[model samples]
Target: MEKYTHLGVYGVLVRDDHILLIQKARGPHKGKWDLPGGSIEFGEEPELTLQREFIEETGLAPITGNIRTAVSYTIIYQYDVNQMEELHHIGIIYDVELLDDQAVLRTDGDGQDSLGAKWIPLETLGLLPLTPFVEMIMEPAVQEESDVGMGTEVEG
Candidate 1:
């Protein structure tokens, strides 16, 4: 067995009670919902990685991206028929805002990892197969109000 570390930059784009997410086309998270981002290229800045990945995965450009937080998770899986590995995934998350709120999302494969992008309601997050990174960030936000009950939601 072997162990390796993979670091990636991701964005959290939220608007009108919905969150932007990319459907994974491959890798350990294949077919699961993930953040719109990927590994940093050699000699590339983390911010650049976030920007490039967002465009690559969502086909939409972000106007502003600010560092929000970092999170990590570990998974054990078979990388090959004869190889098993422990993968530690470290994610650098950013709070991103789009240039145009109504910009259409890319729903076609990016010829790499993403299948497409979609704006999913926060409340429906639990209904999808999400990557660990998505679960880590969303758990707190979604569960924060669970004990209070939705019927108590105050009208704005």
Candidate 2:
């Protein structure tokens, strides 16, 4: 088994009972709905990483936000025929506010991990495939419904 860790900056942008989310194009959370943000580059500040990733993933530029909390998760999965990896992912979450909530978002893939960004109704979150990080951010009821079990829970 291989062990690795990832530290990323994420943003939670909620507006009028809806939350902004991006579709993961790769990784353990591929094909799931996840918050906007990603790995911080070397020499890049967390806040700057948040801003850069937010734009890269969502395409709604000219925004501001602040750190809300820090969250972590651990998952072990197989990436190849006989390869197993234990990934410890740490997220620095931010409370982001868009200047133009009504502005159009980039729905196409960002040519990277994001398939696109969309505003998902809070009430409908449970009905969709969500990353563990998103589930941790959701209400208690939704959290309970998530696949958080022994040695398999996604959040810490």
Candidate 3:
């Protein structure tokens, strides 16, 4: 039987002139840098989902800012083990800022499962091999140009 799953409760965390990224530990994108987030349980709000995800993946309490963008994507996954094919996912990507300035980077496990969380510079982001949509997400915040819908998450 083909399985269709819903993935949510995810966000792109930005902090102190840098963005926080997690190295995937499993699945198709394992070993690649990705925004820290995952599936939202039933009846859970997106913001809550992301906050919970941060603690689970990075061991920090991150605060979300704005809803930068929302897009629905149809992903085709064909599991080689069982030759099963499936499709489905409405990815809700958001912009967020980390409150903990003195936070340290930490890896979850295996240096792949949820391994390594760090704030990398925008310049370096383009150079590194990151997960899908990650590089694009930073484009708005890093650019100097005005009119980039940078909604305020909080006050300093």
Question: Per-residue alpha-carbon lDDT of model 3 for 77-147, expressed as tens digits?
Answer: 55677676554655678777767767655665434358767777865776887766575566665554223
Q: Where in model 3 is the C-alpha error above 4 Å?
A: 1-3, 110-113, 139-156
TM-score, candidate number 2: 0.86
> Which number leads on lDDT?
1
lDDT by residue (24-136, candidate 2, tens digit) is 99888889999999999999999889889988988887678888889999999886789989999999989897887666788896989999999898779989999988988
TM-score of every candidate relative to the true structure: 0.89, 0.86, 0.73
| Alpha-carbon RMSD to native, per candidate | 2.7, 7.1, 5.5
Q: What's the residue-level lDDT of 149 in candidate 2?
A: 28
User: CA lDDT of each candidate?
Assistant: 0.88, 0.86, 0.68
| Clash list (residue pairs), candidate 1 | none
Q: Write the per-residue lDDT of candidate 1 for residues 1-156, one digit (tens) a residue.
A: 899999999999888778999999887788999999999999999999988998888988755699989999899987888988899999999989898877678988698999889999988999999999999888866765463455655343
Who is ahead in lDDT, 2 or 3?
A: 2
By summed lDDT, the worst window of 10 consecutive residues in model 2 runs over: 141-150
Clashes per candidate, residues 3 or more apart or on different chains: 0, 0, 4
